[model samples]
Target: MSIREMSKKIVLCFLLTSCTYSINAQVKDSLSFIKSKKMSDDDLLKKREGTFATGLPDFSSDPVTGFGFGIRSNFYWNGERTNPLFAYTPYLAKLKANVAYYTSNARELILSLDVPYYKGTRWRFKIDFKAQQNPANLYFGSTESTVGNLRLPSDENTTFSTYAAFDKARKTLRPGGVGEAAFVTDALSNRFRETEYMLNLKADYALGNGKWRIMSGYEIQHLSYKTFEGEEADAINPITGEETSAPNGFSLLQRDYDQGKISGLEGGWISILQTALIFDTRDFEPDPTKGYYFEIANEYSSKYIGSQFDFNKLFIQARAYQKLPFGKRTVIAGRLGIGNIFGKNAPFFEFQDQWSPEGSINSLGGKQSLRGYRANRFLARSLWFTNVELRYRIAETKLGKQRFAFGVAPFFDAGTVRDEWQNLNFKNIKYSYGLGARVAWNQSTIISFDYGISKEDKLFYVGIGQAF
Candidate 1:
């Protein structure tokens, strides 16, 4: 089952393409007036009402998505102008439809809508819904995760021979024997077939001053997960990032092997109740220049919530941004996040996937976070990650009425997952450093491309919004 490309050859009207133009216009116009000293930031905000941005790929591909593309739109409506120093608190509605990827073995098509509305100064309501059919999904035996458990079986009793051969060839910086490459892919990235649909509704109520808020949401997810006939040909041999239509060997999962303690291989339904505490004082929400944001959230899914399986998860994240006075346009930002899953024998799929705010990656070993590795490249019981970015605005230009900035970000990321959940040690951490190029549309939308390099792997990332 290919997650239906939903295919490379779908059709869309002008509403999608024109929104890109609209966003460019607003940003350029605002910047022109500001540079000429003719308009104040407040005046620009007043005129910045009803700004929108959208992207429709001619076609695109990533390591995970194989060959995928989509169209997305974000609408920014000026909800209120309570803070004079900051831009408008936008009432936003985001819509998207696209083919995530397709291959000889699996594919996925996704359609989703996310809407957030601010009611007065006290309450905000939001809804996120998505439907996807995914086949040949990747899994690295992390049911009861432990560091390096998914690596090749190294014990003398059952060691794989081809792994050693590839290790030797890697010294030459080459993708070695096709058989060795295909074997490694089968052993590591086991495939599955699943159809999933999720819906979540969230509410945020401001407390006392507007900077502190309480967040709550109800989410229901349906997953029809099952084993698939393993791919016969490795069109995209995951281990080496090589494109060869060679036959793939049997994956360990197809040999009647299961990764974890819990048993939900057939998939089930989970209803989640999530809540969080947020403290934010950022100068801007999209790409903050000053101030910091801290949030801690929990997800509880139980029999009481109608979950076919029960589990709970805890998440804590913080980010800070500051401006350096020496440069005309320079800022530094850092982010940290932690995730833990506990309670009744947690199912493999229940741990975490596709819950990110941007419909991007939430997995630790992915382009969005740990850029150097493949998606879910590493997994364990608990995860912690850090990101630091130095941003420099290189140029500012206008087209029609849209003002935008071309920027560069040199970033460093460090993260690791532990099976036992103990101390953070450098010996167990994975480090990656990278640089990114971006175009910011009125600080409302950002299109970025990043290239990351690590000791073991290198990756290229293309996506919307900041990596946080």
Candidate 2:
């Protein structure tokens, strides 16, 4: 059936099932999920009945002295056949909490934390915990992992080789996933449990004509795995033209057969010192809807003790926007930036190589780049990206005295992954284009959906705005 038809059926089922509920409960569960262009993590936590909290002062009532608090617990899952690379491992749950507050004086702070737990398909409980404070200039929080945020490298050959090896080993050991075999495979042995933490501080100091902002932080991680992923030698019966199988049905004879075994505690700490220079040329004070924002930041980090990675990076992003053709409503904006993950020699980590294109901007899906693919689908040493957008305001209204606004935009994005600094090529860059819809809960929060397209893929992405 068409998506519209499917949507109609879902709405019909929901209405028929809960037509008699109270307005608050109905809105919290059904209406919020359907009416909102995009659902927030906070909403998901509430649905799951977990504790959720926000440190931002409240501005819902009189705006100046208001404070708000919220808590919820929710779990998300994806099965293998649905999303190959992601589901190929196991279906896991994420326990999350979020809280935020904003004062009348314009100071705002938000806290969001996530803890991974439970194993849906595999026997191991592979969990990861992450917490971050937005507007880092305002509060403190953890640094996010590059795993999901950064894109990785990709080549058809490399993709086939790595995944094919994994698949072949899985089929040989599990053989159609029967009983115990279903829970045991080369894929399952590689699973591990890890914890990551970061503390971020961002603040702005205003002078007579412009604003000066500073962002600094530190991060640490602890990875403990029962067994690292490795294959055993393939056992073959030379006399019978057949392969030898072990008691567990694994191919017993193969080269470099490394069995997955629980390794002791392996952890590390990484700290970064960061500072940024910003030039703000606008009419308004601390907050202005229309203005030019420019930033150049330099961050340095030492190797993680008892870990295998080290790097220093320089990040820069600049933005400009101006009123456009349509009435007083439409606006056009553009952003350009360069980001590099550089190291003296090879990386300390084992999974990705410096030239690997798995999680850099050159990869398929990522923030400010492609929306059709998952973030960090590809990785690489260094990357570059550029974007432009045209937006039009659609509507403005108040919901029971709560103000909300909506808008639509068309955007073009370009980026790439590269090995050495000298290997960069902008003329042969990869690009994507899409249309987006955005809704503002208040001035501080907005949710967006982008229906993006590339020559080989088309995707509908939902997240917070803007892409940059």
Candidate 3:
């Protein structure tokens, strides 16, 4: 069986299953084992669920709007493991989608699909797409352990449309996500503008029980002035979607259209090919209690791939999870990640340190990475970051027919950034710490609320699963 054959079987099976009745009343009692294995890396997470979802607030450095709302959902189904594409391995297929609307009249969409047990003894694959239009000023400078966003408050002349457009892109989002445009900043105007668009495909094959694997992917993206997205950036005013003074000077704060330093300022297609070697042994993925995961990869860009510039990217990362002795309910998790750009022509936007390399353009800080500080708060040519968290399961209970477990986590994060590798400093590291509570379903899906404080600022986030 090939990829096409496997897909056909999955579709046919779904059509057949649709004719069946709900099994809640019949099967609810059979899942006691899932509830008992609260701290174990059980196989339950891989089981099919009709549909699951969660939502979070989108907050930012802008004061105009305290927050926006976003929703994430996953619909799972059985995929044909017997298909040659999967090498007759067991697998599950799911569609993940997210849509968010912001007060700045900005919107974002993230969609993707996964193959069964991407980390299991089978083939792994994914198709990802993301697009966002955010117009806001970001903290972009050369510094360590510090971040500064535009403090330029809205004035009487600063109409609703102006502020709304200025705050479309938030400084941070929970767990995983997309970002808005980046506005250039000037002494008189703390604003700059940029747009982000991307699409990519990837596949990986396992070497041993999915512990060792090879991964490869390709992507095409555009990041530049909001105007390049071919959207009405100011014709009718982005806020009310009606004519306003937004087309004028006060409304258009700062537009530093330059290509010398920030390669994508003018915005064009950035194409790249990437490959990696992965080693993972976590008992479970979402909220692991024990095991280790590691990866190293190289990404290259050139005119041959339609990239505007040429460059090579390298990343080496690792993590470990441990369950305590007194009770498996108590666990500790830690991670170490480092990234480097080998080419001088690599676009600055591409240097953004991101949590997941499958599709990330930024680096260093954010809700999913370094909690306390804002996203993209710190970016250096070469840098390393580390995170640690202590999780304690409080107890277990039931919600209707669903199983639930509640817990808490106190976490700490730190990282070092330098203009170059030789400039790395062991004594200088930015730090942050915080506490959070977790609510899980079937002991697999985790929902969390965390409050992190750092030298720069404090951050509050609610999202799915653990940070790593």
Candidate 4:
């Protein structure tokens, strides 16, 4: 179905469901989740008991992915407040499930589970399963090569001026022939379809004093890629003012494969063994008010481990949160991270992903990273980034047994990529600034909306939990 038709149906479904539930309970309480106040660790743990659940319509839009619709549900079981682990973990047990589809032929199904102090021991366990596909994933080349006048206009101009300029450049490079140089100028060169299936299992055992942990995990992942098929609608050829057929994918990825710039275009298995050292002192896992979190994670993929390719990845990250004494319910949070990949046999798809003890952070330009740019807008073997936010809670209220708090955060983000460590420089560092609105539901779930602007793009995002 067309995007418009699908959107209409989704809206109708949401309205019907909302009406059916709203009449039976307060609309706000039924739709939103919980909140908490600053308290001593013992006091905070004492108040969390019983079970809490919340489910919401996952309606969102993105510049590259178009409109998305789905459902997200979170279930939390805190057990009795008297449980010893209550003082050490966010929840005794939790489960999250999400299913979403985007207009750009991108879709995802994810199921995750977390249990801290499992079986009343110091061990914590986590499992995550995901299946996802994206037919229009972005790929703007790597490192310094990605910078230049390679971008097409975001909007068509009067008299097709931008197209006229782009076509002129294409002709200058190829002299009537569409070679690699000329092809790279086309917007279509930046997209290729990919499907990924992943399963992750992890365990962490708390050490003395419960402030340090040893983490280990394993992941099974498979990926495949293809060029888009079928023809697109015709568009005006600015040079001749005549219509020209718009072709589908078959862009940069195909060109790279044919030229041997990369390998494993058909994709294969990538089994990874991971380990990390973690130091955490955050007062709360979901919304930290004062503390620090640090991790140095290493991942290895080898033929002996059943991986089709061989490579090693290292990621280091540090985060801090401090509640301001001068402002009511205010906190300052910051994160710094750096990562690199070793070995010549790593698949191209592996370059854009960052892994840690918590989970995977895909690319440096998306809701989780650059914010203002499209996902995977930049790619390379080495990357570094930083994020800072000033968050202030503005309101709080209770509806029946459910508690909620509203907050706003102003944030700054900066990052860069390089093909190798030797090529890294301070020049051409991409940065963006933005503001975010947050809704704290119960104690663990946070609904977030953010809008960011950079020199190249303006984008908005809506999701669960903080960007970090």
Candidate 5:
């Protein structure tokens, strides 16, 4: 079965289990003579002041990364509600850690800490560190070329006859296609390996009442690439089917490096300094039901900052949430974002990332952007995208001291990338629509499952929090 099909079964099983648990809990409560106490709003506010922890086993499967397993944990300290800032932020202090391994020979380690209104001061400090290695990362060409390079099974060039011939050759030459050297090169030419380490430190100072803030940060990153090697197989003559000595060809990434189309092939360090202005009036930071968030950020990296190359990036984004009049628990959320990079000295890999005060959005495709496409499926110097979601709470219940909420979100996403601002056109835009399942834990953590489809691909994503 396809990966998307398998993911659907997984989600179905999870929902079934949750339903069973809810039924058992209800029966247990009915059998008990005494009812559980329901805390008032004031009591719940007091409960939020103490330290709390939550975590779950991370399980994920996708065509790009295969099956992945890990653990993610979050620790939070809300401080006293009387502190004045407690109501303005998600938490006074927070720490998050995640570690995972994938069947594709990929591994990841991440740690992050956030302290808003640090020590009763106006400054909010944040630090993040990550180390990741993936042997099967996707790497289509960048810029407008990516728009034309994408290939699917239905494409004219990938006819049945062509696929059959390729398959026959593979079976004859490699027999079972074992080992690194025996594996046939992907006809689509879109796979590579990447190892990366990153460190970032940021500080935000509340200007007035914490509704507006000035953000500044420093980041350092090191990245390396490993291109797939060509397959080594015994050649067979097409007509006679007789074996002969021959070699295949280089991987797509290797070919590009040889042609001098890519930089930082040997890997290097990048140092960057960034600043932004943020205006946030959201009712809640994690799952906002009403309000707006806006940010404009600029980043500069140069040799003077201890970087190997020089480049500049700019990003502008706005997000808003509103409750619908017909449904008491319905919310409409939307976001618009645009970004661009300047200078030709930047590495090709850097073009795949967009940055803001909140976090990084990796490319115009993937879970955070175009859910129907693969991660980093499209890369370019300029990009624009938008997302709209209609979220409706379907159910709510209390399990012990934890509050659980189940919701559904119907979403639409559209985006495109180009080599430059002038090259951008609405005619090239791509769009996808999907429905998502949401489970909110203690009104703080949100578990999300989304399935999206485009003309080119279908993808399912399991993640934390909303796509925005």
Candidate 6:
């Protein structure tokens, strides 16, 4: 229950349900409810008028269908801190739903449901699925902690350690066995225990007229755990402190009561067969103030084979956006990428390359990248990532029948972890920056919030749609 204590319990549940009711029966005096709901509030203050005489019709002359279902639940705690960067405090309650059907011949049909209840667990059904096509041409999902939550951050510089810096780095890498000790048997405790499950599938296509396009998918993960098993405690080296001797006499650190059970299952299957060459003249989606949306995406991934981890990659990701005419619906975006992630036996605590000796910040947070970081924190062979965002459109609503929108965004993220391809560029990058929000009711479901910061740490995100 962090995030400033769940934002002070969502502002004390919106000030106890908006201050115990009745500001004249739930506050309704918008010019007497727009003249008793007769509508036409001066054509909503005439925004260049044109809705066919305000009676409002012409739903684009056709096409309109959407269905939805949702639930999100989480209760958290990350106590036990000795300032190892504010140790422990991760809590959650998630509920989800989907029922979508769209037509204009572009076709689409989706049916989904998910329910999760942590802490004492018992809510079941994580996702039920079905699909058909084109619901805005891509950006369909199954939520991976809303997109990877191994706890975030990248380019390995390491942080988030307390419990006495992981009990003084497991007593300086395994000392005098009491079961080898790792996050316990000394300095501070609470090693590990985790549970996970995931599923995903998506599709995309838009050639020529779209300049070019092709996207694909497949994803899965199942992880059950118990951790910390070390080796090397036969010490005797001062300055160099080099001591070896852990052929299994002890050094199994944690996980050896019933020798910890179910400990493997990791999945990955992503296809971004790309082609993009957009030169948006700008009618929308390029708002800083007015225009800029030039895109180039040639991306690919194929080395995350499954259960216990596996990777084989190919990369190229690039993007850019603009719209900053001086506030009032602002916009600015950026993205860049280069990749090559390989694997063999995997499993170094889920493919470790760096970060996880107490580290985490923003490796785009899993499943395919940043929805608030945490999932596969750099298990490398090669990688490079970059991102930037700034969007604004604070408020607009008409509630009663529909039409509502709200927005806010601020972002900057970075990634790096290399071993080849000339050790990838950007001179070993690592970064983080954050703030996000959105509500878009009329557009049919969009509720998201993101908060990220670094100087140490800060990450808060709630989700439903649009982080892409």
Off by over 4 Å in 5: 1-47, 61-67, 103-105, 152-183, 231-249
lDDT order, best first, reads 5, 4, 3, 1, 2, 6
lDDT of 1 by residue, 223-257 (tens): 87755333333344456866555333444343334
**lDDT of predicted model 1:** 0.58
- After superposing candidate 1 on the true structure, give the runs of residues whose Cα lies further than 4 Å from its correct spot: 1-47, 61-66, 79-86, 90-117, 143-189, 226-230, 235-250, 253-262, 352-361, 423-426
For model 2 the TM-score comes to 0.51
Scanning candidate 1 in windows of ten residues, the lowest lDDT window is 31-40
Model 6, C-alpha of 124: deviation from truth (Å): 6.8
Question: How accurate locally, in lDDT, is each candidate?
Answer: 0.58, 0.40, 0.59, 0.71, 0.72, 0.37
lDDT at residue 147 of model 6 (Cα atoms)? 19
Candidate 6: which stretches are off by over 4 Å? Answer: 1-111, 118-125, 128-342, 345-381, 384-393, 401-403, 408-425, 428-439, 442-444, 447-464
State how far residue 380 of model 6 sits from its true place (Å).
Answer: 7.8
Best-first order by TM-score: 4, 5, 1, 3, 2, 6
Q: Compared with the true structure, what per-residue lDDT tens digits does model 6 show for residues 1-468? A: 689999768844643332232224223331121121121232222112111111111112211123332233221121122211111101111222233323433232233322211121221122323333321211101112211212211111333422233223333332343444332222111233333343444333334333233444444544444332342223223346664333222212233223442112222322222233333322222122233334443323334332334444444555555566775556676766565434544333332222110111223333134433444434354566677778787777775555566888878777756556575677635566777887654332456677866433465765555444
TM-score of 1: 0.75
Global CA lDDT of candidate 4, please? 0.71
Worst 10 residues of 2 by lDDT: 134-143
What are the per-residue Cα lDDT tens digits for candidate 4 across 1-468? 999999758744543332222122353232121112123453373344767777789887754467999999887776554444445457767779899999987999999878765655567888899999877677655444553434432222312223245434322211112332221223344567789899999999877666688999999999998763223522346457554544432355666677776666789898999999998877778888888889999999999999998899999999999888865579999998888989876777877778887667866788888877667776788888889999999987777767778999999998888888677667678888899999988767889999987776778888888887
Give the local distance difference test score of model 6. Answer: 0.37
lDDT of 3: 0.59
lDDT of 5: 0.72
Best by TM-score: 4
**Which candidate leads in lDDT?**
5
